[model samples]
Target: MKLNYKEDWPLYLIVLGVITMIAKEAVEVVLTPSKKMTSETNKNEWHQPSLYLDNELKGADREMVLYGENLIANTSYYFGPHGTIQPITNGMNCQNCHLQAGARAWGNNYDAVFATYPKLRDRSGKLETIASRVNDCFERSLNGKAIDTSSKEMQAIVAYITWLGHTVKKGDKPPGSGITQLPYLNRAADPGKGAVVYAEKCQTCHGNHGEGVAEGSGYGYTYPPLWGDHSYNTGAGLFRISRFAGYIKDNMPFNQASHQSPALTDEEAWDVAAFVNSQPRPVKDISHDWPDISKKPVDHPFGPYADGFSEQEHKYGPFQPIADARKVK
Candidate 1:
């Protein structure tokens, strides 16, 4: 039998308050000591991790955040290239990139978005709002058109991101917030070497051709395509070996890999990234990106660089030299 706090007013207030707090912070259940829960850098500091609860929320605000959560978790259904609400993506779910709806640690989670956003991004060299960031994903990652900032869908998404990051203090770098920075390889990673790794480790889920398995009769992907017309455009973050290598190293092969215990070694990760990136995919002109070439990452994979490095050198490794030269200047 449930404990009836019906007549116990004080107990009712206590439980209600607890529920309210739970609703606001959505990630408490799986929080570990290693996670920087309170902006602390200590390896095992104490702090609560939170993931908001939707059932406890009431009325319109609750409805909005919940809808936003749904969009993030089920992006293909609502806004995919063939989605019912709007067809603006390459049929990939947002969760394909932001694992566990942006709740999981080091899974490209949004723990830092709310805390660090409305700030300057060197890529554009402008202060970007959350909406612009979302649109960037639309234009590049999804290979589609931008959703209107004034639209309800955009508002809902922003609301969800805001809720996910509500517990984080502004400017606090929550531990394991984003993908880890993997070490750059001394020699350029080789796509030829990568093919073997992909055949051995990746072909099962991503298909022999990287076309990805379908979820149902629909176009949604069970495992997203690594490279193709339907995959992320060349302008996407994953197009860069540095970015993609770090991503796959942290999480890949379904249930096998993680940020700490990646199934692939650093070289394997880097090479496999090269192999995947070498495949033909849709292209989008990013000539206007990184308006200040001096600030561009060494692996941007495009030209007119501040450093006179070859495009091949930029795409491949030995990136530290370029990185070092930029630092000196």
Candidate 2:
């Protein structure tokens, strides 16, 4: 007997639905492995925490944090050659070195400052406070005299640094808190090779003579001078080849690079640091630095080291030998 087609339509539809469900299950099985891999990769990544000073923050704490961030981001505006406030420092802001007021990861950030200070430092050879550390930068890096630690500006700066590291517990140094360390080269870094890299990659912003670009108002530098009377003095941390090279490896060419994807090779970073440091800049009296010569870093760039290496060897590398000698001792 022939079936009635309209009466059988619902039965046909149910069979079609069952076939569609089986096909979807087969497709999911094919995609499952790739989806699991993506989730695993995402779970392993780490990021620097965001800093906030919004409405939730109030009273003097908020004021201090806000002013501190402003001071760091605009240090040149308040303290540079033609500054409205002090006019004492070379025309470079704290952010020029600290990068994003010390919030950026592996960008010379202050992520460990609050947790680590009030501790003994090898450079100073004394128990130091956060305020003393800030003044150290003022004296050495800014090529200027120190401000009073009790002053509003100083307090604000300390407060901001503390706020940035609030999530970190005392005695714990979080990942990405400081400069990214690059491996040492087997041979001495070459100034001549660095000069070539500077001309090709750095000169457009930092200038042919390393005399960085000036702001329109003529008060501070838009791009900080790498070497000059207006640049950081000889006692600056960046005067060291290793420190400078690591800094360039993570952040350089003025925002063209990052820790995740650096623009310069390790050798190029070392060479460029050597070239920049070889240029003329203001000198600083560092007789008091590293009170114990034995405690001096392998790349201290000065004589009187416990190891008998020449000053030239100390400034540029093959620094692994010096480090090895220290380890043996």
Candidate 3:
């Protein structure tokens, strides 16, 4: 046998494959930390909080805006069961839902509020003022009674939202003003799979029962409940899987998650949304919602829809069909 290199091709191939594997692992080990550190370094480069501190803005107006921010950041402190401000909310901070007191980008921010207000909302089917918007949150998201429009607390919140949008022109819609949406799934999200995700990632903060984690001796929560009496009502935006999925994909697992580095895959986000919505929470009357059924979202979750899909389909979906059929019409 005269050193037949061709006949030994299989051995050469195996050696090459082994070398390639080692090279890839080595590259990964060296580069992964470097990439992560670079990302960490650039974290502060994004937009600042755009805060107006007391020193920068003095007087009664400044105090009111700060109080408004406080109301949003700690709703329970001034408005919970122990609250001296008349106790309107169900012991959850507005920041619990708003995320960073409506400062964080794509965290259901209030940047568009000042400009977009007095606009028609399909849900209400009328032009709603900022006061109406705030009251809407109280009635549904907070599962609490509406605040009087002229009340000092309500005025403070409106002032804060107004200040948040101060830089933008009246008619201009600011980017990153609200929760960013995720691409619709081709199939229904799986609640069973979501249960596993919730256990591994969410249950620690939201609690094993989805009842939330209370902070200190006060009624406020460190992490708001995903479901139960204290959480947003069934009629809240979070009750819709479409809204909830986007919310989780952008912001979940507390500080460890964001839109840039979504800890959960799209599948995980959808599944977790399904799991959360399937749980029990307080209900609100939505008899007047979607006054024009044709204008309703594909994921509205309640029916008699304009299309023929079942209520279950609306709740958990491959919603492309519904959207497509509507588009054709």
**Top-scoring candidate (TM-score):** 2
Better of 2 and 3 by lDDT: 2
Identify the candidate with maximal lDDT.
Answer: 2
Report every candidate's CA lDDT.
0.83, 0.87, 0.84
What TM-score does structure 3 among the candidates reach?
A: 0.84
Lowest summed-lDDT stretch of 10 residues in model 3?
45-54
Kindly list the per-residue Cα lDDT of model 2 for residues 1-329, writing each as its tens digit: 67677998887799999999999999999998988876664454224455453556788898998899999998988888877878878878888889888888778899888888899999888999999999889988899989989999999999999888876778877656778678989999999999999998899999989999888977667788999888899999999989999999989876899876789999999999999999999999998999999998878888788887999899987899999988898
Ten contiguous residues minimizing lDDT sum, candidate 1: 44-53
Ranking by TM-score: 2, 3, 1
User: Which residues of candidate 3, in runs, are more than 4 Å off?
Assistant: 1-49, 52-56
lDDT of 1 by residue, 52-79 (tens): 5445557887778778888888888988
Using Cα atoms with residue i matched to residue i, what is each candidate's TM-score against the true structure?
0.83, 0.85, 0.84
Record all residue pairs in model 3 with backbone atoms less than 3 Å apart, i.e. clashing.
none
**Higher-lDDT candidate of 1 and 3:** 3
